[model samples]
Target: MGDILVDRQEMKKKVEKFKANGPSEPLDNIELKNPFPVMLKEDMMKMADAHKQQHHNFVQKLKSRSNERLEIPLKQNSKIDSNFDELANMSLDSDDFKKVSGCYHINIDAKLHEELCSKFYLKKSPPMSVTKYLERVNRLLCPSTASLLTAAYFLFNTVFNLKPSNMTCVVPLEAPPEDEGEIQMSPVNSRNIFRLILGCLRLSLKLIEDKNYKQRYYCKVVGMQNMPEMLRLELAEMFMLDSHLFINQYVLTRFIFQFKVFDHNVRLLFASMK
Candidate 1:
């Protein structure tokens, strides 16, 4: 019995020795912790492919939506014909006219006839009259141009107290020639061309100051008509000199003049009154 007990003790010691030698080896199939590899390579590949596809799609969408614009021609299927009504209801002829006329015309630097002829293509034939030129201007140019011409007429009459008369716009048949040294720097005066639009604007402002000017056509008469006959002849002469410069300095520059020519103090005063 003592021998049997000694054998059993020896077997227990062997078992402890085996355990202390090293960790137990895993089975081929029943792995202890998936030692085959914890790699997520497939998942990583899928994520990479997804990113590439998204980038490609974004580039395609951008290319498809670039620079898509459309332009429509004027005088097409459009219909809005109330020009007269529009003019009647405009604020352009309101207070602005008064501001302009009060400034330049007070001095005789009123470039009226040149202002008219610039708008119309006139014949320089021997007997060119304001009435004849006006007839052509009325028939050829827009109402706005006509209005400007008429405004110039009144501007001349009121400031210098002139009347309209038939006169050749050209210098008389045998007038003395300008001196070689004396240069004539005339104001711009094309109807179609606007020189010193600011000057014109100044004229307009002065013409509209009367309350009853618009009601009984007084504005037309006092502002556009009623020019002294001598001034009318002078205007005719002015229009005859040049047309292109007249447009540039007058019509195109008209808006610019409003800001450039008027005094800052006057603008502030106007603003305060408003």
Candidate 2:
């Protein structure tokens, strides 16, 4: 009973003090903490460079197709690609890449792009560089950016066959390409580059977008009189890929980076030839 009375008295005292002083409020203005560690501008710049190097190293390790080597299973709770081409090993992992229906980041390796440029140059005859051909193609097709990027992506994979095969043959095959259902693609070159681009661009547009140009539209746009040849090329490309033309953002970004490098190198090669 004495202890309870003492507690009541203390509470009464606090109340009285509050009434007298109109309630004491704590101040939050005082700066009592130590200064936070801060980097100099130069140090920050060096740190940024270090971060970039670390990122580069991480991407460098992603080269091989071995899931064990990468330690990142290509299909991490992802769907198996619909490609029927036995030779195609590329997987954008669009399902896993888009974890929980959200897209994520990806990086490309320098060596892969180097291979892209090397393969592009490897096939062509002298004087007919990739730049000249690409320019001719751009002028001829007047393709949209999405289709162009997709076509470039396809071209990269077709050349390397390192990713999902992007082999789009504009030329109709006379002989049976394979003994079984295996895909057989001819190399890209000056002779068929136009047809290849036409097929790839048209197919890419169809695959990537909702509304697409018709066969007659492509013929009119490309100034081609023969709709049959154009249709054949498109069908041939579709067959070559076994109708597996899906491209996700991850694949698209990687190829965009690679295509930039390819375009730059092609222009440089063209400049040097002059």
Candidate 3:
């Protein structure tokens, strides 16, 4: 009996030892051939660069498709006045540029404007530029309209992958003055409406082409308390929240901005028709 008890105690000890070091069942039949090693620094950098390139390419494709569907048509329409294209060009060197100087900060030049507009409708003769027109138009549009356009333009230019920019504590100019945390705009002249609208259009194409412009510029409008109610609402609708829907936000926003800016001016030119 003493021997049997001793043997039983030895057997219990062996079982406990086995339980302590028992192999866990393999996960989903994935037997480890070799354990995953820590990633090297070089390998990690390569992975990061690869991810950034892939992200840029994906955004380019998205912006391209949108541009094709929307801006391309207006560009092709023969009925639209060809002079507007020239006017776009003239704004660069002509005294007319001075008329809209209030809207354009000194940083943007006439040459840059020409470069921006020509991307959509590769025009010859005086070289029509969108950037120049935007500078002028923003000044011409109502103050409220200009404010909205400028804000929209900056937003369109800077965002990565249909994502809104990580805009921080520069309180939007539109915020209530009574609010303790609000930010205010400095005393400056220039219409934001045309800027925003044209900026959206320019950005849409730039994003598609993956050009240097989109890479360099990315500033949203700060304060926009005086934006026209109708224009503001329309622009907000155009800036899309979802990528899965029917139309591309970039293309749609550009079109809406252009129409809103030009439709009135064109109407005035032919106001007699009414």
Number of the top-ranking candidate, with TM-score as the measure: 2
- lDDT, model 2, position 47: 87
What is the Cα-based TM-score of model 3?
0.19
Q: Residues 68-155, candidate 1: write the lDDT tens digits.
A: 2111111221121122223333465455332322222121223553354344332332244446555553443323432454355433
lDDT of 3 at 214: 24
lDDT of each: 0.34, 0.49, 0.37
**Per-residue CA lDDT of candidate 2, range 1-274, in tens?**
3432345566577556655766245523433222112334468889888976775454444433324431223343222222212113324453332222221111123344333333222233445555675676577556556677787666544443333322221111121123323332345666556555666677787776575557676686654567886676677665544455777544554454455666899999999999
The lowest-lDDT stretch of 10 consecutive residues in candidate 1 is 166-175
Superposition error at 230 for model 3 (Å): 23
Q: Write the per-residue lDDT of candidate 3 for residues 1-274, one digit (tens) a residue.
A: 3432345566567657656866477544543323222344468889988976775565455445535743332233222233232344554645554332212111122344334333322122223244665555344432333234333544433221132221211111121224233222221113333333443544334334333422213222212233353234334323422221122333344435544665688788799777
Better of 2 and 3 by TM-score: 2
Residue 120 displacement (Å), model 3: 23
Model 1 ranges with Cα > 4 A deviation: 1-142, 145-233, 236-245, 249-251, 254-264, 269-274
Q: State which candidate, 1 or 3, has the greater TM-score.
A: 3
Candidate 2 positional error at 271, Å = 10
Candidate 2 regions exceeding 4 Å error are 1-142, 165-187, 211-214, 260-274
- With candidate 2 superimposed using the best TM-score fit, by how many Å does residue 273's alpha carbon deviate from the native? 11
Error of 2 at 128 (Å): 12
- Model 2, CA-based lDDT: 0.49
